[model samples]
Target: MMLGLKTLLLFGLGGQELLLIALIVLLLFGGAKIPELMRGMGKGVKSFKEGMKEVDEVKKDIENEVKKDEE
Candidate 1:
């Protein structure tokens, strides 16, 4: 079972390859800075979601106005 799982994970990337990439990231940023990086990414994602909600609301308003005009 473990072997099958490992093979699935390594379909395109070997275990060594993944480990090397992770090691590079850790070395470049250090473990202490990872949380701060993740926090900033979270804030960015939240802001994007809020912006999308505003756009959707505006689209609904426009559609309602168009329907009223047709009536």
Candidate 2:
């Protein structure tokens, strides 16, 4: 069975639980900083994705080199 993102991240947390968590975050960070935090998170995720792509390209190159050697 393939577990979806909600199942993996939320782990059965209901709407009320999500709302409570959001409220806590709002209180701790305040509304003004939320946008900045989200922006930083977006940048971080973008960087991580780019890094993963580079790693995959390197792995493919290595595999191709091995195949060339074997042939």
Best by TM-score: 2
| Candidate 2 deviant stretches above 4 angstroms | 1-10
Task: Give the alpha carbon lDDT tens digit for every residue of 1-71 in model 1.
Answer: 47645885868777787788779989999999989987998899789989999999999999999999999
* Pairs clashing within candidate 2: none
What would the per-residue lDDT of candidate 2 be over residues 17-62, giving only the tens digit for each residue?
Answer: 8688889999999999999998998899789989999999999999
lDDT value, residue 1 of candidate 1:
47
What overall lDDT goes with each candidate model? 0.87, 0.86
Query: What 10-residue stretch in candidate 2 is worst by lDDT?
Result: 1-10
Instruction: Report the error of model 2 at residue 26, Å.
Output: 0.4
Best prediction by lDDT: 1
Candidate 1, superposed: residue stretches over 4 Å from native? 1-20
Clashes of each: 0, 0
